[model samples]
Target: MMVNCCGLLTSQKEPVPLKSVEVELEVRDHVATVVSTLSYENKEDKPLEAVFVFPLPGDAAVCHFSAQIGQMQIVAEVKEKQEAREEYDDALSSGQQAFLLEESEQSPDIFSLSVGSLPPGESASIRLEYVTELAVQADDGLRFCLPAVLNPRYQPQGSGGGEGGNVQVTSVQVTSVPASLVPYSLSFSARVSSPRPVSKVESNCPLDPLQYLNTEQTQTTVKLAAGHKFDRDVELLIYYKDAHQPTAVVEAGRASSEPGTLMGDPVMMLSLYPEFPQAVMSSVASCGEFVFLLDRSGSMQGARMKSAMDTLLLLLKSLPMGCYFNIHSFGSSYEHIFPESVEYNQKTMEEALKNVAEMKANLGGTEILKPLKHIYSQPCIPSQPRQLFVFTDGEVGNTKDVINLVKQNSGSHRCFSFGIGEGASSALINGLAKEGGGHAQFITGTDRMQPKVMQSLRFALQPAVQDISVKWDLPKGVSVIDLSPPITALFQGQRSLVYAQLTGQGSEASEGCVTVRYSLAGHPSQNQLHFSLKPAEDTGLTVHRLAARTLIRSLEMEKREWRGQEDGGDKKKKVVELSVQSGVSSAFTAFIAVNKGNSEVIQGPLVRRNVPTPMVMACGMRRQCVPMSYDASPVMNMMALRQAEPCSLKKRSLPKQPPRDPLLQLVSLQKASGCWVLDPDLAAALGKTSEEVEKPKPASVNQEVWATILALIWLHGFKMDAQEEWELLAMKAVSWLQAQKASCVTECVDAGNALLGCTVQKDVLGL
Candidate 1:
């Protein structure tokens, strides 16, 4: 059989060699700790070695790796990358089983695992553990994604070696396949506990009904539905009832470790959702130089380009009247709408909108670095802070270089980035915003681009939070030993996590408190959280490992800053020492395990095989579309529009039967209370089932608010052209919207407009 492994087609002499995979995830507060166990068997009648290249969340910090063969278990230890590789090679040559795990130097999201010299018919169980901070979505849900697909990244010509000259391990092109066709099974389960009540949980894949463990709903457990194939990426969205509340947790360190060390002390994780005064929010600057950078790369050729254009339209229209703006589109190269940023007048805005409408993903490869350099070279407008809005599918391989550039220029501008589509590189999207001191958002299937873009626009316009500090109040004997880096910036409603080591012994009854202080619009504000000194339940080494990851990240940032300078060596050494001490894998270190218990030395040349992984076709596409060359003529603009027309016309046209008229259907589905409830009938008209819509909403979501919003969206979308036909219904919606101040009607309308591609005036709705 010929198998598609990565981008290479190879003939396989046996059935799919890789077997089942099991994943155990534990989420505490805003961080998630994941343990993956892969079971593989050597079915061939010879010694075999396997190489598997897989994808992980870009920010994951791998902390543990071990292999179990028969009854012997060998735990891996963190070692310098080169040394680990050499040791593994020696073990393999000496007829010993060895396992090595190393992260790709070029892309943080990719990792290569090698399991060597497994005897015939013997099975090996490989277990790996990692820790990462879950990203908060625009709707305030915490998102945890396990990447099961590794789409081949397009590397442009003349790009040279990326960051380091790390050889490309594998190129896996996404291919469409039915779930049943996949050869492997996946079993996943997660335990979620938060300071705030766990309202609900959602997943892209089928999941068993959630089981709450406590009446307060502070803890819950969920697992994958039975007989689930390893098909698409596994995504879980968790919502907390009081997500914005400030909370503190102190985790006890490892008891067996010596005192005065990271493992010996208690660690406190502080989560702060800073609420800036409304006056400060309203005082955001109305004058700034806004530069919009759109990705025209080939990977963004379909719905992504359309979404970008739509987002650009919304952003261009929302800019302050007196702000200056410019638009740039880049692929292999870049083109600008204007020679430089011009005043946001009617003429400029109209011209930019026209150009954006005609924009297409004709640019060959994603070459963002050159254009970034060009943008940075331009002089900044006096007193008008530069804000860059980057829209991309985040397919670039030179992620580290791009982020470093953004970091170097952080002082001059703030960056807001959007990652388009499912396979978008989280590293690029999150790194750009993190290094540039701004915000990041990801848009996937059916996600309205406008609301997220507009939210980012509001963030860009907000005044910078300055003079941030954290103060600790504890008993005299208790002190903070190692503290994470100081807070660089803060935005309203965004949660900031701070990790610190609480050293020394204090009475369990003592009160420990922390206060976060920052300046907003020249006004000083502080948020204080108090907790007992008593250590929380034993979470093993989760807190310590998380703290180590934080410190390692800070050290890596410092290394980037000292890239070509003399201090680089010292920073590298420190990172290595910290990684080794904590058993966490870093850029300079890897995890290696070797088994020496085998009494009989069976020496033979092991057949090396690369294990294949299932590919996920791009969202909304049925087949993989090959990107045209850089010099190819532009086709995506016309093609996309043509393909979109059928759907548009279908949506606009009423059904042949009056009973099926979408507007009438929606009205018929509404309750006597004048709100369209999320019922099965209404969901069917919207091309979804009620269960799908209702399952994701937590107790925090007011059904009335959501139902009203849906009804308004339906009216604004399908009935806009025939308002006379539904004016009575529209009036009722308007009245209902007015009566309910519980929801932000204006924001809802904006979100609806963005999703439906309509420009409904908020003033018309009396918002």
Candidate 2:
């Protein structure tokens, strides 16, 4: 998780720069040219000083452009325009162009400047105009940054005119560029510099993969013979030392063909791992008090909203018997569905879920931090495990303020945050969680939220091991260290994970026991658990921060590479440390490297299992994401496919590329037909029937026609009765097609017509 370590500042104040990135690229006649434009909008309550900096490529053969900022006089730069050799179309029109002005059929370039930084409620627009020669190529070669500065600040513009100083820009846009010239990289960052520093800063961690694994049922294993691939799920044990109880994590699973044997189709597979110490289950417990902050924002209108609701329903249904909970939802406005924290009675819970279902999302502004402050100020119910769970897609009105608020209010209450979807603010969620002494979790897509919600709810209900804290035992010369927050509240017997970083040249590893102090609900004194960290042979400062730093740097560099090609060369840049960092850690770093490209194509054990298949296609939009098992469960496969490609069903067949597996289709059809059933006629035709010579029955009327051709061939023994067979096949085919509403889906009608036309017209009608 990337974080701006500074304390929260008021939105009314100016923002200071915390970091700067610049990108450089070679320019040539053959290289992609920079086609740029700028548009400005003032939507805020202040006049924002906008400065757009588009740096030139290092090896530019030529560069030319006209620039302007509204009606104000501004300095503009002009470079030599590259020579063009294409035949000029003088007769096309008076505006006959020399360069090829090919327009893309889709995804044309556009620059929009909406009103921004108007007085409290007003709005205004800033104009922009620019043009450059077309350097046709597959790749882009220019760079730019929105607010290109190191220490940026802004002030609210009053009715009086103020001194017009150097304007600093924070964002950029492209114009007159081909769709194919789109770059494959992009980076985004916002930092708070020179701010009021109250306390802590945080780093956001990627969501735990185990949270996506479905675990509602007992672990089931299926054995596969050689040459078989089976999709499935398995339970993983989440254990920590000195915790009350161990937690179980489920994983969606799959096993491909193992080594030898004739590979016809994938069948089944399973595994048995070495078991750890026997886990002791703890008594059922419930939190003292809880608040569920849900987002009912506009962007979460369809599938995402459905998934969120469904997951909420599941949690409501499974809440502990005596737990107390509150329901809070926000979008343009905030609503406490339950006026106050209420007991977990069946009626109240049902009413809450119903309210969520009936909710009409009033999508507009996102006022995140304000509502939390209100909730925090309310009097708490004493003696209960007091906590708040902020559930959102992580968009915020002001991130820094929200983080600071959570941190300040977290002394007596724990705040756990769950990011619902891709647009969620990682930094905000992480900060809220860290400040509230809770773990922050991110759900990438709607379908992934259910399992995570279930696991989190279960954990929240478990007895806490007590408040956990961490302090660095700094070695000599180690200064200016940056440390991640301490993870608190382990299960009664579980261990906590706490890490810290120290800056400096030299520091020897020291032997010391890190003490974890916590207390059970109703317990007397705090219990102190100690874990010894004997400086392993590997105690290098760089070694410890390798994983964390690499992930950050790789993402940073990727953004620069992206800007180089997108906004037309050298407008933005980053150091190569990013790529090096991506090569380090085995886990987190791997995510950074792969996240830069298409996730599906960069396959891995986890990636393969998560890739959308036919199963996902059939699930439709989830009301709430539920933990999913990828095993050979026909229902699950259908559900996966439904959610992933709801529209893919319109297509008759899956992609024909042989490299693309046909198994997904087969599995889809199998599930659609209600699982495997004996094909009696095929068995009879093979003379391998087991006293059951059943006639061919189509899975549906559509498939029944497909069976008719085979039945006719069998009846006439493939000879003299060919015409009769043709007539029968045609009759059945047309009838089945009609019943199946063939015309509704073109594929069914087309297939039916082709088959009947082939047999009836050629043999029976002789036309």
Candidate 3:
């Protein structure tokens, strides 16, 4: 009954006086707005400064921040980060209460919030709001994840210093407390509405039964169930009947803002979901350079390591023949499966599979950038499109730096990224896919990684969409400016959002149209949306804030690209300007609030408190696999990291975890040629003895061909519900048999079906 919490920086042994957290989430279509109110009370004998470093969704844009201390309510304003920091420090020195919120330069998703000079017996409430677009999951569900702030994010070596150092957050030791003795409480609620009917809402946490707000089922409300731990991530998968419907929202400008500015001008958020023709989608390309980059970091122990091995099995078997492929595993350094890219035929695939089976979570630390450089440095094979598949736990410290590298080499290949566990950095996963023009998938909780990884693999095999353009067709004389960057690549059922500024005056009744055109393989496709120029009152500043964030990220990237140039500072200035204008939090800007009304003298020295990363449960007992805290200073933090033990989880008293997946056991028996050898392992995976399974083999067919047939029938007949996960593997097996042109395939299939107690037809097995 111990809840996990991310302990913050504190001068004292006890944590900060955080009492409760209240969250309200609203989802309209694919966009979500979350408002969190944290209640704190100073129960200490003296004044305390509370600095909390926490995680937010990587792509969320903070648009509002404020604090309520006693009867005084102080609204914060966005300013330059340094200026805000100085003001907060100055306020604390003056013995006045102040609040500061700044995004971490090391990772945009990590934010530092400092509440200074809270006198004893005083209470304060902090309100924070942000908006983000939900990512589509493998099953067409829109996924929204509230990350667990308590999980440790491993900092790469030589990081956490200088201007954008990881020094802002220093973890302190904290222990698990029973639920009955917990210091804080959490309240969470969500309201959802979409153009399509909401089919259902699911979460890893227990939730109250969803209540429909309307008969159409488009509107509903849900909240966490009673006694929820509020630990781990709160992941919600919202399924809709027709989620791909194209829609547009035009939000009204702020009444008090300048007309020419981002906040004053009406912003149109157009959503385009293109469903490609099945004819094109069904045709998988036979040629591509497939590079799989894996994280063998020590943190990928236990369940994570097993998940990676299972996913690799699927990926290795799913490769199309004649394609070039290689496997790279990285931690402190990287190792490759081959000297270079090799043709994925019988011989090469077996060598790769054998080596992959021997992989372990022994590599030292999470050092992703090094291996990425190695992958990108390789020259692309001629006549083969480069498709890079990266799998990681996303514990790296340099999120932006890694993303920038991906962006620089984006033109060379498409990168499909998979975040492997509960705490994967959404920023890293989303950024890689966005910049590399591919798709991103996340595997969380007990979810099978194979289906999601296989989905991305399918996307990688699809013909690339090129020559993309967004055409604005607004009312004449009412000019428009596109706030979003150009369209990159579009996949079936994925939502593409385009935000634009409507500058010139237009008739309220007049329509504004936008069209997105792209070439898929050789065929041209276009999707368009038309909306009235009249502002949408209910939407308020949601669309505008989202637009501002898009522009800010682009500017930040530009600022990085132009660094050391004369215009570098100018570009940075523009980013700060826009951030202030739109009232959105950015890397260059922070939100600061000061309580000028407090006139009390200093009670004690200022101290900051953060929620400590909690001790995780291990081996069915309350134990820690590694140190959960570091020194609360930049220098000491680095020292702690260097001295910290790798999480090999080598506890002497603990039993070994079952690593091999049951399904993977079957997949592991697959030969490089996609055929299963008639062995005891194969029979065991089939839940039979070798003597029993071998009895059904046709004399004309070889052992491998018959074993492969039985595997296909087992997958189709018994595991049809998991078709998506093993569809490619089954296809590979059938292809191997088809290559033999064995007329006895029918006899083998029927006999294998009898042995496996499955009545699967040969056609159903895709033979």
Candidate 4:
């Protein structure tokens, strides 16, 4: 979640310093370089100071920060956090123009910026640049998000608060305000180039038609519509002809920097897409211990609660019969469906489904750590690997603590996490998956959770990739120093990135090969890529900055693990040194810029102003925005952001009927064994009467077998596009039909396909 907003301004009519923002996005392959420029004007009588806080992607490496006042410009320098703060204070006291930016001590995703000693009637421009890799969506699209999380985090007492106990988050009360009401102007543009052909681009926000630069369709440009306001999150999903191709980019280092340093040498980024054998992929595992953790916090009141329940129903119905499973929900406290995980059977599944239906968002606040700790404490079932599925809106205050706990127990279990709703913490969601040897997915803005959830479940069922190692083979006199941590998990078609330093000297025409070796389900295999060592032309220091950020994060995690030990200090020093050398902002570093051009020191008492930002949102296009009103100011102090409690009368619980969804209706009729019996509900789901479906059944086929085949055929015919959501359950049904060993299986399939008006073949339905 990354949002830029001011706190508040005195006299709403008074002009504020911050006026407008313009952003440029340059995407080269999977990496993105973003540049944002903000224009501010001080219209007050005396010299004043302004402070603003905002959110950023947790993994982004902020590489540049600068400010321009009139004709003079100052480029900020990255320095130790304490030293930068002291310099900022000294410059402010001396009445010199200064700017300071630093990450929160507790939350990496939040930062504060202060502008000091700005003279009256002066205009200034601030520029910030960063680089980050895009996340790969389940459908193979590359996802880039300009995230806007207006909702303040929800936290309870002692729910993962950090050592820096003073946490403050500003919230403004309003519904969906119109974009025109916002004071600031915004413009966004993007240029995308890829090795593969650019198929298309889609976004949650409206964009001008994509313009291709060449006939090959490898390069293109797109921009936001003229009427777009910087209110809601802006997301872009880019697709390519072959998205799974592996790539390697080698970038040259800065000339002025000394050799043998992170900045002065060549850096290589390897993008590896693992390939799994089809024999293993075709079979879904039926044995595992599946545990689900859900967030029942008060913030998850309406739509979120409904989606969460719908996803749980799909999960419960799709589980393999021999597996063990349990359901856990948490708020300020936690509760479980059973004392421990119970075997997955008809009775247990029914009981779990019934309890799931009754669950609500009435649980007080977000406290996920307790439930996670409890789950990890439970004994792992022998021969049944533990797969933990965690779902939340990601509002916890102790994100680092929770992530560390996941890493500690990562050896025994795999964690699949889902960040539900807008404003979910990317840090918490990505951190849990990265540490627990599983995958993470974010569901937001009309995105269906069931598909993404089922995809992750498939990853969980895939045989684990173990004993992974990366080996680099370069020319003589060239050695490599790996920057990324060791690979712990891999899923078929998922991209894994590796960064390394190219040390020593090599000919410009030298070619190098890198091999990735891993064992999947006891079969040892390897993937190799050979590429030229020549430094890429016109490729800036984006790769180096990202590499530095990765190393810094790995070291920070190590520092946390080595806390109170002598090695921790060394790791901290290394992080600060590398951060300064690479000109990137880290938790231990801050960016500071100062101006001493004004020789006169005739400043009086300086007034401080906090600008207020109203959050006006528009969904898909420029012509439409949510009609409600909202005031979302994003100046944060790494504390829990709870919606200010509204005193209301306690409401009585009502037994409401579940809505009749065609998909869920069909899904619910499938038994635990994955066979559908002939019933009126099943017929209704398939849009036919029970007698009509029963009359055409083959003489050799029983009612159960015919109904099961009909369900499979209907899913293939009507819901083919949503295969990701129902693929697992459909596979189970196919397995059950095979187990029956009916002689007329093909006859039943052909008849069912004709009845459903589907041309699907027996093989396609897995009959």
Candidate 5:
């Protein structure tokens, strides 16, 4: 047995020493290319092998890996995973230096790297390179995260056992220590280039001041601050000016390949920002079945759970009177607010609000699969489209399985997903929305939940775009081969990227045009884009690689959909061939390196060591606790009850304050027109900022009606317990609302209820 510096394992032998690490990242537009170099030295007298388990972004596609032994550099080659493993084992047994890397079948975020048979006192340097798309935050800032912490995922009872039931329930060991105690040193730097001006760069970790490389402010460089330990995940948020503009880039293909092939042809990437007509925006359906699947796992404790509750309150209040709704909270198991979805009347809305307030993260572990299966098993109401809103910390291990299930049920409903907190799994959050044809939003740091949640609700309420088609008009000799799959969904003010291979190049002076045609709210609409045919300068194959990646993903998705059939084998083989040809690593192919110099067959028993990762300190848990484990027994009920005690204590320890009169507050906060402006002062009183309050507004809301509705909601929602004290002020607000004809009172009330989680009566307001 082998151990790591964190002391996560009990081993009889000494642990190997890991030296320093260097990281380099290049971010262009919304994609990131990362390279990491790890150095290791073996101080033992005998030859030794080192195995290191590490974390990576779940969606990253590893492109290159190589190892340096002494003065020899051996580059890796992509091959079938099992074949690569066999070759690596044979090389190690023959006393040749070899390196092997494989992603965990249990978790895509975890990877194991083996440096085998290093002679005593010899040092080996390993380099890895990967590319991943950066997710856009709700604020339109691009988010890039380097994961340094790996929290152990607990498998639920009766679930498929870990590693086929032979391995320990918790296969990976996680240890937590103070930042200063970490032995590893990290050096990271990034060069960012985008079409839009770089507004600013922010990070959770300390960073040096950003340096602009050009006068245009479109290119910049940033590095970590001095004395940064490899502790928490390194997160960078990059903001760009004019972020929503549509653009296109034409890239010259590889000069070394045949002209007819995909790599040898020119490629074009088009970014389309569709702007729906105002008439279409105002035509959203008022009735639908809204199902909420909330994660109540231990990881979602504290601020995450609070945010979910706030979001749920807004959703409950926003539902139309005739819409059907239900709420399901899940961890190890799930509990529903009602046996079936009920119409969103005053009674049901109030009941949901009360139950939502009591929802907690007392659930044991994140076991979302069963709850999702259950939700899909229920029948959807006719004429009312089903919209599923999932709020989670996104710590599930079976991400692919979950996404597959959602895809299988995509026809029945659309899924809008919210990823809460830092280091949430992008694979799960983004995959769910992508497969289910909906939008994805992430909430982190001090970001408010109202705007993002309400934006998704609006999307859900909008009628789906239909009859999508693309038509291209190019100069003579110019042909297009579509690289991306057909567009499945579109939303107003949202950007969609289409990539195509432009073969049989046209004249440099010629121009090409493309039009996207679709129907929104039963009205036919089309967007036309025109661009020069000239190839852009110095693109450096970024567009080509991205196009390849997109095609690979589409093919892989098809394979997953057709899995277990005869065609699955053909699809799998095609994916491997394409991956190898493009030098892109896939789920079926691995990069392997071997150093065959001085191949003397003298070797002892090779030691297999598992490196320990830093445990993520989450959910108010202390650092001294062991890594979380789940047993295949029915003890979760007791565990959940025990967990609730600490939560109750935490709640009780907060200092108590006398409740303020909400009606008096509302009256004091009202403007001169008997309306609330949702300005900074009023926003502060409502525990929000002016920016948050003003961000997400439906097209149908009128300022006057909205302000009056908010004022009335403030009085009704908070002062109901002391109605006698504020009855006069509430009546005045209701009268003001009744007098307003400038806006549709019904729409304003619905918007206010959705935002404030209040069920103010329209009839009482005489609207």
Candidate 6:
């Protein structure tokens, strides 16, 4: 059997053989020996600088070391450096005796351990005494890399333990540094060829890279400015059955702007919550109304709901007995079992917990807004911080409306949404949290739901910042040009700091400071705190504008889709105008926005009464369908001209669903107040007929198809050839959807509208 191991970086070299390796089982008279020696004759013509990588436990400590080989000695010390450097250094330092090594006199940097030399044809031996403080075995491991050393010849002895005994490399990491830093284009690859077929592939990359890819199918564009610096680790894994093909790569370079405009609002980039410097066992007193709005819809009936209920129970049990709590169950209807401020006595809490456990998924519709609004409307302690946790798959009638309600109803309370399934709407949950000045979390896998939800709830309930303000006290000559809204402070563990982008060049400054102040809930408060600053080293007017514009485009896209108007319905209404006014085609607005680096724009109602502009008229198609076809665009062309960039549109799954009338089949899939088709392909499948098979619309559309339509409208407006025309069909389908039992809401009208009736129903049900 092959012992498989995994690591970060990888290589093409064979695993070193365990020559004369010994595993001692006994430690007698303090003369214990655990020699795990591996030797190999240098077959290649280059010296070997082997880095013995180890995945030591976080609390592991090296005690002593002894090595015998020539006059060469080893060096070791505790490294306190960036995590990246620490990993690299740890691998090289492992196995070398601590006492005999050339131990550093000063505190170790991240890459601290070193061995001077193991000359060619020279054998070296070392003994190390260390103990790992980890309570669990899984936390201990080591990793290393051996690069070709000075002028020497050697080939690492492959795990030549027969065909069945292949050398297994553990904790391997193959990475690439930027060419700007390394001046080289080195690629890393790993091979995990075994007698058995390959089973799995793994990947790890930074959040920015993943966001750039937009794996969530969002039309959002992530931009990097010219002078701005960014570093990210991108890991790609390709698993294959063949030998030597388990390869991965990390690509890094200058990234240009993504096309398709999303208008952005000036926002606070970072939170300014004060860190709870020290935690003590103080009286964890609780006040205010604590509402637990649970998703008890039919979808939540299985392990999803079960896990959520158990988690909620665990949380309820853990709450200090002094806190007030309420339980609300929502589905087709909602039931608030307890009053707004239920006393948390032993009996009351136990009964509430029982009620929660007994609560079952009933009805179907997810009436989220009503419960949230109800919580907001209820009278409660005005000064105490209110917290409402919505635990569900986030399958709601109207997410936008619920968010709006929460925002509007916010008095002294915060709204937190917990998504409990893979299909949970990230946008909805995240938007709700953002809009409500709270936090949103998505919990996947039933087994992990309880722990994840509890963790999120714990943080959500802990307020780190309140009444936060960030002010830029500029120099004498400096002026305040523009700034985005200070973002709501989010808690990071127990501390919070706010960050914002300030744009304005100063000729000279007597003094400059960014002042931040916020209340720390149960902690202390401050006002007008100042952060001194100097002229920004990285200041690019063009890149800043572009970044701002790109953000605006993304926000606009989000808003446009939020207003679900199928059939290019309201395309003529310059409802929301991106600031690129001089463009010939509305589609070019995205290009112009990028070209000019302007982010400020107006959005509200695309008033139809506004003077009919040629661009709007030409592009005035509802459900702006961004062509899924891999074709050139003015924006792409502009990007190419500016930076020689290339972007390809991913192909649609239903290539044949476009041309044909999709309404015919769509109407059939509608079930009264229960099932509604959100996927365009499913709608198209429902719309198509056997007779239409000869000229069936390209493949059918999915929910993403509708999104693409909206994106196209954002770009070209309501302009498309007959073959690409699907707006009318979409309109018909939306009408059918509107008339359907209202379980489904398109990006057209938002999940909020569909839930309005549910809100009424919930109200009637005494939610």
Best by TM-score: 3
TM-score to true structure, per model: 0.79, 0.38, 0.92, 0.90, 0.81, 0.39
- Best-matching candidate per lDDT: 4
* Candidate that beats the other on TM-score, 1 or 4, i.e. the better one: 4
lDDT of 2 at 300: 51
Question: Whole-model lDDT for model 4 versus the true structure?
Answer: 0.80
Ranking by TM-score: 3, 4, 5, 1, 6, 2
Give residue 109's lDDT in candidate 1 (0 to 100). Answer: 76
Q: Model 6, which residues run further than 4 Å from truth?
A: 1-273, 279-283, 382-384, 460-464, 486-504, 507-512, 521-767
lDDT of candidates 1 onward, in order: 0.74, 0.34, 0.79, 0.80, 0.72, 0.35
lDDT of 1 by residue, 1-767 (tens): 75435522223423445687899999987889999999988877888887776778878889889999888999999998889999988998889899999876556777888899988889999999999989887678999988875544545445543211112432222222233345567889999998789988988778999999998999999998997766667889999987888777788877787778887788887778888888777554768999999988655776788767766765664566578999999977899999999998667877887788798777666779888999999999997889999998776666777888998898899999998866677878888998888889877656667667877877887898788888889899999965677777788898887888988889887998888898887788998888887777867777788788788766776666786888789889988888898887777888999897887775678887666555434333324232211112224422332233222234466546324446445654543234566677766766556766565444554676666666666676666665533444445455555676655555566655654466777776545
Residues 204-300 of candidate 5: C-alpha lDDT, one tens digit per residue:
8889999999999999999999998766678899999988777778988889977977778998999887888887776547678999999998777
Candidate 2 per-residue lDDT over residues 528-547, each given as its tens digit: 32222223232122222322
Which of candidates 3 and 4 is the stronger one according to TM-score? 3
Counting clashing residue pairs in each candidate, in order, gives 0, 71, 9, 13, 0, 88
Q: Over 4 Å off in model 3, which ranges?
A: 1-12, 158-183, 613-625, 632-662, 678-681, 689-691, 694-704, 744-746
Q: Is candidate 1 or candidate 3 better by lDDT?
A: 3
TM-score computed on alpha carbons, candidate 2: 0.38
Residue pairs in candidate 5 whose N, alpha carbon or C atoms collide under 3 angstroms: none
